[model samples]
Target: MSLSALLFPSDAMAQQSGIKRIDLQRHDLSVFGYETVQARIDFEPGTAFGMHSHPGEEVIYVLEGLLECKFQ
Candidate 1:
């Protein structure tokens, strides 16, 4: 298993009860099982994710806010 960090807006957080979201299921994470993805997500001010991806070919999307994404 892997671990990640994140943040969310008060209103959004209130709805989720202070839970952040860093989704790894970005358009089939299974495609890249040889990669290490790390990043921070904050919604208080805004939402952002750092570099994320595995080896081989894959597709990704934030589905919400803009993603500062990079592949390695």
Candidate 2:
């Protein structure tokens, strides 16, 4: 599997009724040694994220299926 495929799989579906969410990253958040948080998002497919950038840093990763990102 390509890196993209490994990081992000196919489309995602919303939680069915009575089924609880069990995403580790969502349920168990990562602790960053910072007081003022800037940005943090956990996305399933169909979840939306706007374009982003920062001071010489452009970081992107997938916590779940195919976090389709576009910036311009």
Candidate 3:
């Protein structure tokens, strides 16, 4: 799957849920079959994303507000 597909909600869902995603950069890694993706995601108050997982490592930095995360 594409990076956007893995990291973002569907367009219709995002519109309905007041979520916005801005892709900052995407680059292929030196290792074959690996890549890195950077993005800025904004969520309106009370908005929440569904459960999902990524293929590679993920790093998140929240600019402001409370963010709750769950992991298995």
Best by TM-score: 3
Q: What is the lDDT of residue 8 in candidate 1?
A: 21
In Å, residue 51's CA in model 1 sits off its true spot by 5.6
Candidates sorted on lDDT, descending: 3, 1, 2
lDDT of 3 by residue, 16-64 (tens): 5567777777789898987786767777788866776656776667777
Q: How many clashes in candidate 1?
A: 2
Q: List the residue pairs that clash in candidate 3.
A: none
lDDT, candidate 2, equals 0.32
TM-score of each: 0.25, 0.33, 0.74
Q: Give lDDT for model 1.
A: 0.37
Model 3 TM:
0.74
Would you list the rank order by TM-score, best first?
3, 2, 1
Best-performing candidate as measured by lDDT: 3
> Better model by lDDT, 2 or 3?
3
For candidate 3, give the lDDT. Answer: 0.64
Off by over 4 Å in 1: 1-53
lDDT of each: 0.37, 0.32, 0.64
Q: What's the residue-level lDDT of 40 in candidate 1? A: 32
